[model samples]
Target: MKVGLIGFGKAGKAVANVILQSNEYSLEWVLRQSTILEHRHVPEFLGIDSKEPGLIFSTSSIEIEELLSKHPVDIIIDFSSSNGIYSYGKAAASRKIIIISAISHYDEDEKQFLSELSSKTIVFWSPNISLGVNYLMFAAKLLKKIAPWVDIEIIEEHFKGKPGVSGTAIKLAKELDLEETEISSIRAGGIVSKHEIIFGFPYQTVRLIHEAISREAFGNGVLFVADNLADKKEGFYTFEDLLSPYFTN
Candidate 1:
């Protein structure tokens, strides 16, 4: 499979490295606005030889369309902000290319735009793509069934530079049919990522936590979703879908 990457941020770079190390997928193109003035040397930043074949680098949608026309990819992995979703989503949908997006904090307009785009092509969207985080969502469902009377709350902490509440916490709350206000967001230190689900009962308390020690955890989950969704039909999917097998077992 051939793959295109959008955004060269921390998560994008980590996902690209994982793709580069795999023989199953070819890293074809990378789209980013930050490299428009970098003399077309995007591969250099990715530690790849500049002369590598089938690797097109561009900073705009026009260039991306031209490159896709000449060298089409099977999928495009997006780690960009919500603002770029409509443009990138429409571009990929027009080409019938699958999109795996890990972007978070989308406004209502952006969310609706993406939902419409999914009608044209497969869109696998997940804010928190870590398997453990998705598994936490699965666990939340079970808890809701087994302990319906318990009060639940989510606490998420991330690096100081991170913005908005943790998507994982929001997802967990949504899955459990709880209010978003039940989540607490913390930003401090250099914490990679940590989420705790507290279940309080009249007599005892239970807690479930998942801590991301490194970016590789997220990268692995992205690759896993990409590989699983590569052959899937055109539709919308999520990381929780990837955890179905575990729950059935």
Candidate 2:
């Protein structure tokens, strides 16, 4: 499969490296707002020019569409911000290309846009793409199923530069009837990702924790999603869906 990456940030770069190492896919094009020459190492790190990389730098939607037409991408993995989600999703949907975004929440406008493409295209969405977190979500469901009496609380912490609460934590809290549970966040040095789900009773406490020693952990999940989703058609899918193959119990 040929892939088109829509963002060049940390997560994007990490996913790109994964694609390069894997044998199943190739990097077709990387879309950005600046020329390749402007950033000295962007080309080297992205394997640009090594195998004749197709780097696209454009601010116009028409230009992006034209580039996609020329290259003919199978999937567009987007880690772009919230503002770019609607426009990029629309553009990719208009072309019937598959899209997977790091941003998860969809307002009414995005919902309508997705509804328009019901069977023709698919846009996989996830707030957090770490496979470990997906496994944690699965565990949460199992705990709820086997011991629904257990009370659950989720806590997540990230580096100081990171912003916002863990959408996954909130989702888990809401799922386990603990949305009102105390959520503690920490912003400190050298931390990538940390999450702990605690279930307690009078005598014992059960804890499930997933720690990310590096950003590559989350990026690996994104690459896994991109690689596995080439043949799937229109609908909303998540990292949890990707882990379903191993979730048989």
Tell me, by lDDT, which candidate is best. Answer: 1
Model 2: worst 10 consecutive residues (lDDT sum): 34-43
- Residues 31-136 of candidate 1: C-alpha lDDT, one tens digit per residue: 7777452334335556765343434355644566676787688888888788877656777898889888888677789778878888889888888887787787
Top of the candidates by TM-score? 1
Each model's lDDT comes to 0.78, 0.70
Judge candidate 1 against the unseen true structure and give its global Cα lDDT, from 0 to 1.
Answer: 0.78
TM-score of each: 0.89, 0.85
Candidate 2, 1-249: lDDT as tens digits: 777877777777776666656566677767766454332343476664445354545444336767777777877877666656655666687777887777645566765665665456777777777778778888887887788887667788887877767766776776677754467777788687788988886689989998978767766787778777877767777776677877675
Report per-prediction Cα RMSD to one decimal: 2.5, 2.9
Off by over 4 Å in 2: 34-43, 46-56, 60-62, 104-108
**Candidate 2, residue 239: how far the Cα is off, in Å:** 2.7
